[model samples]
Target: MILDLNQFVSKERPYWDELTAVLKKQEEQPDWKMSLPEARRFHYLYQRASSDLVKLKTFAGEVEVAQFLENLVARSYSRLHEKRGSTIPFRPVHWFLRVFPSTFRRHWIAFMISLFSFLIGGLFGAGVMKFAPQHKTSFIGSFSHLSGKPSDRVAKEEKKQFDGFERRNTFSAQLMANNIRVTILAMVVGVFFGIFTVFLLFYNGIILGVVVFDYIADGQGVFLTGWLLPHGSVEIPAIILGGQAGLIIAHAMFGWGTNLRLAQRFRRIRSDLLTIVGGAALMLVWAGLVESFLSQYHGPTVYPIKIAFGVLQLIALICFLLFAGRTRQPDSIHAG
Candidate 1:
């Protein structure tokens, strides 16, 4: 076979340069994390450069070009292999501020599906309550307290004084435990192809919708907002995150877009699953504390302040999920 070395070198030089630039950036930012597309591109460039090195070695006249290719291949090889070989120590701040949110963004579509399912359930429940008020007991039967009029509950709650610190702490702990259990169940049930996950989310949303509609219809909307928004804002989103994680697991189970084996798919998503669930758990803890200490309180004097606080917290959370851990530019590979 005849070889055109000059043409081959010209064709591949751009790739070589691009790979060099990527390697340089990686060297500069040891802790930088690449998106999946960027990672794939990096791997492709590495393999291509390695192949170029082999072909160059076959024709011995271009010693300089061959050495350059060899060095580029070696650097990429070391960078790639060292990461797999090494253990990166966990940094809580970094994980919370970057890893968790970035992962949430990565699978935003799943989160949207989870959210949409919940909203649909909420609408259905609200419709039932609005038109068929007699069936309210079917949904609120589990909570004997909510069976009464919302105005009555609000009046009774406002008349009561704040419970002591010890009682509130105990209540907070109990709330945290219950919420965490529910959230974990939402995630673990993804093993059943996420069917149960969607059901759990929908069911919870139904209960919420029923309660909200009941209160609003009775003209207790202010009380409901003051009572729930403080903690419910964070708590509801946390549960949705659980649903998100569940859907992710379901996707892996289905092996939607790849030919990877079942075990391989699960392995790839394991870290992301852990990060999401862990973040949701933390949010639940905060929600529980707020529910016990602040949300349980009710009065005209405190309602406005509580509503403001809840709104601000919710805005902060949305911003964090949308923008946190976002880099100035993606680490993309292009011809240099």
Candidate 2:
């Protein structure tokens, strides 16, 4: 086949130069990490340059260009296959503050799907409660305590006080254990193509919707908000994050866009799953502490404070997820 060597060299030189610039930058900052898009582009450039070198070798005249392309491909290959180790030590604070949030943003679509499933369940539960009150018991399930009137329950809780710090601590431990178990289950069930994970999320949302609607319908909206928001603000999101991890796992199982093997797909997403679940666990721990220490408290005097705290916490979390880990400077390259 006749080859337009001059046209090809002209067209490919820009890509080769771009690869050179990226390589130079990496050499200057050995700890720098490429974002996903940058990594993909770099890979494409490597492959293209390698192809160009092969084509050039077929012709005997372009020796200098061929050598340059060979070196470019070699450097890119080395960088791509380098040992998966970081020169910088792992820092827990950095991981939580930056890595966790960044990971969450990376899979925001899955998170939205998780949230949507929960909302659908909530709507269903609320509809049942509003239209058919007798079946409340069926929907309430384990939360039989809420079967009674919201006002009566609120009154009882308002007058109730903890007997001692020991009781509070015990309650907190129980809450933590229960919530963490639920969150873990939500993530682990992703192995089943996320069907169970979606159901779990939806079921939890049904309980929430039923409880919230019942309280509001009975004129206990303020009480309900104060009781739930303090801990639910973080606890709810944590559970949703667990759902997100599950869906991510499910996507890997399906392997919709890639031809990678099942093992390879799982390997690619394993770190992301762990990162999301770990973040959720941490959030649940905080939620448990808040629920036991603050959320369980009742009365008009403290309700506003608890509500405010919860709102602020939720806002801070939103900001962290949206903006954390974003910087002009490069980060350390780490596996997903």
Q: Between which residue pairs do clashes occur in model 2?
A: none
What is every candidate's alpha-carbon RMSD to the true fold? 12.7, 13.3
Off by over 4 Å in 1: 1-85, 330-336
| Residue 225 shift from truth in candidate 2, angstroms | 0.4
- Model 2, C-alpha of 75: deviation from truth (Å): 32
TM-score for model 2? Answer: 0.72
TM-score of each: 0.73, 0.72
TM-score of 1: 0.73
| Model 2: residue 146 alpha-carbon error in angstroms | 1.5
Worst 10 residues of 2 by lDDT: 82-91
lDDT of 1 by residue, 25-119 (tens): 98998877778899889999999998887777775457788889889999999887865425788899999999999999999998998998899
Q: Per-residue lDDT for 334 in model 1? A: 86
Residue-level lDDT tens digits of model 2 in 283-328: 9999999999898889999999999998999999899899998767
RMSD of 2: 13.3
